[model samples]
Target: MFNGLSFEKLLLVGVIAVFLLGPDKLPSYAAKLGRLVRTLRDYANGAKVRMKEEMGPEFDDVDWKKLDPRQYDPRRIIREALLDDAPAAAVPVIKPVSRPEPAYLSRQKDAVPSQAHDDSATPFDSEST
Candidate 1:
Protein backbone atom coordinates (compact mmCIF):
# COMPACT_ATOMS: atom_id res chain seq x y z
CA MET A 1 0.00 0.00 0.00
CA PHE A 2 2.68 2.46 0.99
CA ASN A 3 5.20 0.91 -1.40
CA GLY A 4 4.93 3.99 -3.63
CA LEU A 5 6.27 6.25 -0.83
CA SER A 6 9.72 7.58 -1.82
CA PHE A 7 12.53 9.24 0.19
CA GLU A 8 11.91 12.58 -1.52
CA LYS A 9 8.20 12.47 -0.76
CA LEU A 10 8.85 11.42 2.80
CA LEU A 11 11.33 14.28 3.27
CA LEU A 12 8.89 16.78 1.79
CA VAL A 13 6.11 15.47 4.03
CA GLY A 14 8.44 15.66 7.04
CA VAL A 15 9.30 19.27 6.22
CA ILE A 16 5.64 20.21 5.86
CA ALA A 17 4.71 18.39 9.06
CA VAL A 18 7.56 20.03 10.96
CA PHE A 19 6.51 23.45 9.71
CA LEU A 20 2.92 22.83 10.81
CA LEU A 21 3.78 21.33 14.21
CA GLY A 22 6.94 23.37 14.91
CA PRO A 23 10.50 21.99 15.46
CA ASP A 24 9.97 21.55 19.22
CA LYS A 25 6.96 19.23 18.76
CA LEU A 26 8.10 17.51 15.51
CA PRO A 27 9.54 14.41 17.20
CA SER A 28 6.34 13.79 19.17
CA TYR A 29 4.21 14.42 16.12
CA ALA A 30 6.34 12.01 14.03
CA ALA A 31 6.15 9.39 16.76
CA LYS A 32 2.36 9.76 16.83
CA LEU A 33 2.21 9.40 13.04
CA GLY A 34 4.39 6.31 13.23
CA ARG A 35 2.06 4.79 15.86
CA LEU A 36 -0.96 5.67 13.71
CA VAL A 37 0.57 3.99 10.66
CA ARG A 38 1.43 0.88 12.69
CA THR A 39 -2.08 0.78 14.16
CA LEU A 40 -3.61 1.17 10.71
CA ARG A 41 -1.46 -1.66 9.34
CA ASP A 42 -2.38 -3.96 12.23
CA TYR A 43 -6.05 -3.13 11.78
CA ALA A 44 -5.82 -3.82 8.04
CA ASN A 45 -4.17 -7.20 8.64
CA GLY A 46 -6.80 -8.09 11.28
CA ALA A 47 -9.52 -7.13 8.82
CA LYS A 48 -8.00 -9.31 6.15
CA VAL A 49 -7.96 -12.29 8.51
CA ARG A 50 -11.54 -11.58 9.59
CA MET A 51 -12.70 -11.23 5.99
CA LYS A 52 -11.02 -14.49 5.03
CA GLU A 53 -12.65 -16.25 7.96
CA GLU A 54 -16.08 -14.77 7.17
CA MET A 55 -15.88 -15.62 3.47
CA GLY A 56 -14.47 -19.10 4.18
CA PRO A 57 -15.10 -21.51 1.25
CA GLU A 58 -16.56 -18.75 -0.92
CA PHE A 59 -13.13 -17.07 -1.18
CA ASP A 60 -11.09 -20.21 -0.54
CA ASP A 61 -10.38 -20.48 -4.27
CA VAL A 62 -8.79 -17.02 -4.26
CA ASP A 63 -5.04 -16.74 -3.62
CA TRP A 64 -4.86 -13.72 -1.27
CA LYS A 65 -1.06 -13.96 -1.05
CA LYS A 66 -0.94 -12.98 -4.74
CA LEU A 67 -3.15 -9.87 -4.28
CA ASP A 68 -0.52 -7.40 -5.48
CA PRO A 69 -1.70 -4.84 -8.10
CA ARG A 70 0.61 -6.18 -10.81
CA GLN A 71 -1.05 -9.63 -10.70
CA TYR A 72 -4.64 -8.34 -10.18
CA ASP A 73 -5.20 -6.36 -13.36
CA PRO A 74 -8.90 -5.61 -14.20
CA ARG A 75 -8.49 -5.92 -17.99
CA ARG A 76 -6.81 -9.32 -17.70
CA ILE A 77 -9.46 -10.49 -15.20
CA ILE A 78 -12.27 -9.40 -17.56
CA ARG A 79 -10.63 -11.05 -20.56
CA GLU A 80 -10.14 -14.31 -18.66
CA ALA A 81 -13.74 -14.19 -17.37
CA LEU A 82 -15.05 -13.59 -20.91
CA LEU A 83 -13.02 -16.51 -22.24
CA ASP A 84 -14.21 -18.73 -19.40
CA ASP A 85 -17.87 -17.81 -20.01
CA ALA A 86 -17.71 -18.60 -23.75
CA PRO A 87 -18.82 -22.09 -24.80
CA ALA A 88 -16.00 -24.34 -26.03
CA ALA A 89 -17.72 -24.93 -29.40
CA ALA A 90 -18.47 -21.23 -29.86
CA VAL A 91 -14.74 -20.50 -30.35
CA PRO A 92 -13.45 -21.05 -33.88
CA VAL A 93 -11.25 -24.16 -34.31
CA ILE A 94 -7.89 -23.45 -35.87
CA LYS A 95 -5.99 -26.22 -37.61
CA PRO A 96 -2.21 -25.78 -37.26
CA VAL A 97 -0.58 -24.96 -40.62
CA SER A 98 1.76 -27.73 -41.76
CA ARG A 99 5.31 -27.00 -42.98
CA PRO A 100 6.50 -28.16 -46.42
CA GLU A 101 8.74 -31.22 -46.40
CA PRO A 102 12.49 -30.71 -46.96
CA ALA A 103 14.01 -31.72 -50.29
CA TYR A 104 16.18 -34.86 -50.30
CA LEU A 105 19.44 -35.40 -52.31
CA SER A 106 20.45 -38.98 -53.28
CA ARG A 107 23.74 -38.35 -55.19
CA GLN A 108 27.26 -38.34 -53.58
CA LYS A 109 28.56 -35.76 -56.21
CA ASP A 110 25.74 -33.44 -55.18
CA ALA A 111 26.86 -33.82 -51.53
CA VAL A 112 30.34 -32.63 -52.67
CA PRO A 113 31.09 -29.50 -54.87
CA SER A 114 29.55 -29.28 -58.44
CA GLN A 115 31.63 -29.60 -61.64
CA ALA A 116 31.77 -25.75 -61.91
CA HIS A 117 33.42 -25.58 -58.46
CA ASP A 118 37.22 -25.94 -57.83
CA ASP A 119 38.30 -29.29 -56.24
CA SER A 120 41.78 -27.86 -55.37
CA ALA A 121 42.88 -28.68 -51.81
CA THR A 122 43.46 -25.72 -49.54
CA PRO A 123 45.49 -25.51 -46.29
CA PHE A 124 42.44 -24.57 -44.12
CA ASP A 125 39.43 -25.06 -46.48
CA SER A 126 37.44 -26.85 -43.72
CA GLU A 127 38.02 -24.03 -41.15
CA SER A 128 38.13 -20.96 -43.52
CA THR A 129 34.37 -21.01 -44.17
Candidate 2:
Protein backbone atom coordinates (compact mmCIF):
# COMPACT_ATOMS: atom_id res chain seq x y z
CA MET A 1 0.00 0.00 0.00
CA PHE A 2 2.92 2.34 0.68
CA ASN A 3 4.55 1.92 -2.73
CA GLY A 4 5.90 5.51 -2.89
CA LEU A 5 7.57 5.39 0.56
CA SER A 6 10.10 2.82 1.84
CA PHE A 7 10.77 1.82 5.49
CA GLU A 8 13.91 3.98 5.65
CA LYS A 9 12.02 7.12 4.57
CA LEU A 10 9.29 6.44 7.13
CA LEU A 11 11.89 5.94 9.88
CA LEU A 12 13.60 9.24 8.91
CA VAL A 13 10.24 11.10 9.05
CA GLY A 14 9.52 9.60 12.51
CA VAL A 15 12.90 10.66 13.83
CA ILE A 16 12.42 14.20 12.44
CA ALA A 17 8.95 14.43 14.01
CA VAL A 18 10.32 13.28 17.39
CA PHE A 19 13.00 16.00 17.35
CA LEU A 20 10.63 18.74 16.13
CA LEU A 21 7.73 17.98 18.50
CA GLY A 22 9.87 16.82 21.41
CA PRO A 23 9.28 13.50 23.32
CA ASP A 24 6.51 14.88 25.60
CA LYS A 25 4.08 15.88 22.75
CA LEU A 26 4.90 12.95 20.38
CA PRO A 27 2.61 10.43 22.10
CA SER A 28 -0.45 12.74 21.93
CA TYR A 29 0.30 13.58 18.28
CA ALA A 30 0.61 9.89 17.44
CA ALA A 31 -2.73 9.18 19.12
CA LYS A 32 -4.37 12.02 17.15
CA LEU A 33 -2.87 10.72 13.88
CA GLY A 34 -4.15 7.19 14.63
CA ARG A 35 -7.65 8.51 15.34
CA LEU A 36 -7.58 10.52 12.10
CA VAL A 37 -6.59 7.47 10.07
CA ARG A 38 -9.31 5.36 11.78
CA THR A 39 -11.95 8.00 11.09
CA LEU A 40 -10.95 8.22 7.43
CA ARG A 41 -11.14 4.43 7.07
CA ASP A 42 -14.60 4.37 8.67
CA TYR A 43 -15.85 7.12 6.33
CA ALA A 44 -14.48 5.26 3.30
CA ASN A 45 -16.14 2.01 4.37
CA GLY A 46 -19.44 3.78 5.02
CA ALA A 47 -19.35 5.38 1.56
CA LYS A 48 -18.65 2.04 -0.12
CA VAL A 49 -21.51 0.39 1.79
CA ARG A 50 -23.88 3.22 0.90
CA MET A 51 -22.91 3.00 -2.78
CA LYS A 52 -23.43 -0.76 -2.84
CA GLU A 53 -26.83 -0.40 -1.20
CA GLU A 54 -27.89 2.27 -3.70
CA MET A 55 -26.64 0.38 -6.79
CA GLY A 56 -28.27 -2.94 -5.88
CA PRO A 57 -26.76 -6.42 -6.46
CA GLU A 58 -25.89 -5.60 -10.12
CA PHE A 59 -23.09 -3.35 -8.80
CA ASP A 60 -21.10 -6.39 -7.71
CA ASP A 61 -21.46 -7.99 -11.17
CA VAL A 62 -19.95 -5.02 -13.05
CA ASP A 63 -16.57 -5.49 -14.81
CA TRP A 64 -14.57 -2.77 -13.00
CA LYS A 65 -11.43 -3.20 -15.14
CA LYS A 66 -13.37 -2.60 -18.36
CA LEU A 67 -14.76 0.65 -16.95
CA ASP A 68 -11.31 1.95 -15.89
CA PRO A 69 -10.39 5.31 -17.56
CA ARG A 70 -6.83 4.08 -18.20
CA GLN A 71 -8.18 1.58 -20.75
CA TYR A 72 -9.50 4.37 -23.05
CA ASP A 73 -7.41 5.02 -26.22
CA PRO A 74 -8.65 7.24 -29.08
CA ARG A 75 -6.34 5.59 -31.64
CA ARG A 76 -7.56 2.09 -30.77
CA ILE A 77 -11.20 3.23 -30.88
CA ILE A 78 -10.75 4.79 -34.38
CA ARG A 79 -8.84 1.71 -35.66
CA GLU A 80 -11.62 -0.59 -34.49
CA ALA A 81 -14.23 1.67 -36.11
CA LEU A 82 -12.42 1.57 -39.49
CA LEU A 83 -11.89 -2.23 -39.43
CA ASP A 84 -14.54 -4.92 -40.14
CA ASP A 85 -14.63 -8.74 -39.98
CA ALA A 86 -16.82 -9.19 -43.11
CA PRO A 87 -15.45 -10.69 -46.37
CA ALA A 88 -14.44 -8.33 -49.26
CA ALA A 89 -17.32 -9.64 -51.44
CA ALA A 90 -19.85 -8.51 -48.79
CA VAL A 91 -18.84 -4.82 -49.21
CA PRO A 92 -20.48 -2.52 -51.77
CA VAL A 93 -18.52 -0.80 -54.62
CA ILE A 94 -19.29 2.87 -55.40
CA LYS A 95 -18.73 3.88 -59.08
CA PRO A 96 -17.57 7.40 -60.03
CA VAL A 97 -20.12 9.90 -61.39
CA SER A 98 -20.19 10.36 -65.22
CA ARG A 99 -21.06 13.79 -66.71
CA PRO A 100 -21.56 14.81 -70.38
CA GLU A 101 -18.68 16.76 -71.96
CA PRO A 102 -19.22 20.54 -72.05
CA ALA A 103 -19.97 21.96 -75.57
CA TYR A 104 -17.23 24.63 -75.26
CA LEU A 105 -14.47 21.98 -75.01
CA SER A 106 -15.51 20.06 -78.20
CA ARG A 107 -16.46 23.08 -80.38
CA GLN A 108 -14.43 25.85 -82.12
CA LYS A 109 -13.16 28.83 -80.03
CA ASP A 110 -15.49 31.25 -81.95
CA ALA A 111 -18.59 29.21 -80.92
CA VAL A 112 -20.87 30.81 -78.30
CA PRO A 113 -20.81 29.35 -74.81
CA SER A 114 -23.68 26.93 -73.99
CA GLN A 115 -26.41 27.88 -71.44
CA ALA A 116 -25.01 25.21 -69.08
CA HIS A 117 -21.63 27.01 -68.93
CA ASP A 118 -23.01 30.59 -68.87
CA ASP A 119 -25.71 29.99 -66.25
CA SER A 120 -24.80 30.74 -62.60
CA ALA A 121 -26.45 27.43 -61.64
CA THR A 122 -23.58 25.46 -63.25
CA PRO A 123 -21.68 23.28 -60.78
CA PHE A 124 -18.00 24.10 -60.11
CA ASP A 125 -15.35 21.96 -61.85
CA SER A 126 -11.81 22.12 -60.57
CA GLU A 127 -10.11 20.21 -63.42
CA SER A 128 -11.80 22.20 -66.29
CA THR A 129 -12.47 25.94 -66.58
- Name the best candidate (by TM-score): 2
lDDT of 2 by residue, 1-129 (tens): 578998999999999999999999999999999999999999999998998999999889989999998999999998987796666566677898886666655553456656334545555554565
Report clash pairs, candidate 1. Answer: none
Residue clash pairs of candidate 2: none
- The worst-scoring run of ten residues by lDDT in candidate 2 lies at 115-124
- Runs with alpha carbons beyond 4 Å of true place in candidate 1: 1-5, 63-129
Give each model a TM-score. Answer: 0.41, 0.57
Query: Candidate 2 — which residues are off by over 4 angstroms?
Result: 70-90, 96-129
User: Residue by residue across 51-83, what tens digits does model 1's lDDT show?
Assistant: 889998777888667875677778988989888
Local distance difference test scores for all models = 0.75, 0.83
Query: How many pairs of residues in model 1 come into backbone collision?
Result: 0
Please count the clashing residue pairs in each candidate, in the order shown.
0, 0
